[model samples]
Target: MTTDPPPEPNREPTPGRLHRARTAFRRWRRTRPFWAAVWTGLGGFVIFFLPMAPLGKILQVGLGGIAGMAGGVLLMAMALLILLLPGQRHTAGVIAVIAGVASFPLSNLGGLFVGMVLSVLGGSMAFAWLPEKPARRRRPRRTTPSAETPVSLGSGSA
Candidate 1:
């Protein structure tokens, strides 16, 4: 007799569309908000470090720290607060967006440009990412006979 082919070692049945969608939602729900906040913080931190660059240094020498770097420092502080405080993320998201916009004048460096973009994206994502509610399962209804059918109490009167 010819031998049947062996089953694939670790293969499993593919999930249905609904199952796959639900799984994707669960994964996104878990990470999207956290990553958004992280990006915002990272952007702000980058803005803070722009001063160490050669171009930034030259500008720093000319403009002094107050006019050149204060906005970056403020942005960094706001980002750090957002990262450190979980309960205030909504507020932090608002702050991050504001600071990212305001930081434009701080250093006017490439880092500020990159940081502004990232912080805006991250802050908006943080504000907008909401967890999806699970679909509720409904019970099937049992149909009962309506009207017409009469029941006798065994009177035997025919």
Candidate 2:
């Protein structure tokens, strides 16, 4: 009987779909306003995890859970608007600023520290960011001095 061929050598495993997606995302560069909006939204989300409480109380505001959630939700909505509505970015920026200011009382000093900082940064960027225009390729004019053009030199020159 003929002998069987030897087994092939092991090969390295390929990256999974999720890994590829993450790599693509990392490679993608976003505009300043986009990054700002993402950061602000992230900050707002962080605030939601903290306990709802007044400045001194810190994370002890469980009694007003609904209110705390409401504030967080509002901030998230504004951030979404900033991202989704490019035309309304200015308006969204204004809202983000308001949310940052409100975060101090709504989520206490912790929110003020995190949420306010991120929101304010994002708001300012959104408000100030301008879309960049693509550069145009212009050909240098191929100009040659006209033969009829006059050139003056010392009268003694031949």
Q: Which candidate number has the best lDDT?
A: 2
lDDT by residue for model 1 (53-150), tens? 57665664665334335555665565566555655667777877877776666556525489788777777766775645677999899977677877
The per-candidate count of clashes, in order, stands at: 0, 1
lDDT of 2 at 132: 64
Off by over 4 Å in 1: 1-32, 53-87, 109-112, 134-137, 140-158
- Where does the lowest 10-residue lDDT sum fall in candidate 1? 63-72
Model 2 clash count equals 1
Q: Compared with the true structure, what per-residue lDDT tens digits does model 2 show for residues 15-114?
A: 9999999887754434335776787687677666555546556435543344455666776787788777766888888887777777776666536488
Cα lDDT computed for each candidate against the true fold = 0.67, 0.70
